[model samples]
Target: MVLPNLNWRAFIRSQPINIMSRSFAAIFAGYLVAATGSGLLALIIPLPASQSVLIAMMLSFSFYVAAAIWAFSVGTSRQAWRDLLLISAILYIFILWVS
Candidate 1:
């Protein structure tokens, strides 16, 4: 009896481009949003400087988680990038304006 040869290459496949783009946006763009948003928050919060910074740092985590979830949950990776980048840009502009 002869054993049939199996093609292993057929079983392997690369990740879809959308997934990679979304992952990139989730990690990098998300961080941008969180960092800039935190900076802006730190500047504007009414508490003492130190306490405001602490509060912003804590809120930054929520922003990051929300960004990551949003990246994956959106209908398209393009939308995710647009939203995160837009928010990051707005936060950055606010930070510059405030301080």
Candidate 2:
């Protein structure tokens, strides 16, 4: 059988699509923040190299969870995207500065 044509406008405006967008922000953006935060910590912590790396990795788990919370707690998916992307940009810039 032939496949039906997809309605791009309806798909874009649907509630589930909105939720999916927010969920993507939560999982992937959260991961980006966590990874960037870990790298920053690894550079900045004053411990021995190995110890600082370990501590940074351990502490990054909290960053991941907090980012997920931040993504969902916002009023809208667009706001979620805005806030998370802004945070990711800031963290990445700091990483560059620290390096």
Per-model TM-score, in order, reads 0.80, 0.84
**Looking at model 1, which ten-residue stretch has the lowest summed lDDT?**
6-15
Candidate 1, residue 22: Cα displacement in angstroms equals 0.7
On residues 1-99, what C-alpha lDDT tens digit does candidate 2 reach at each position? 997898998888688998898899989988988998899999999999999999999999999999899888888888988888888889889999988
- Judged by whole-model lDDT over C-alpha atoms, candidate 1 comes out at 0.91
Angstrom error of the Cα, residue 15, model 1: value is 5.8
Evaluated against the true structure, the overall lDDT of model 2 is 0.90
Q: Give the residue spans of candidate 1 off by over 4 A.
A: 1-15
Instruction: State the lDDT of candidate 1 residue by residue for 58-88, as single tens digits.
Output: 9999999999999999987889999999999
In angstroms, how far off is 28's CA in candidate 2?
Answer: 0.8
Clashing residue pairs in candidate 2 (N, C-alpha, C atoms within 3 angstroms): none
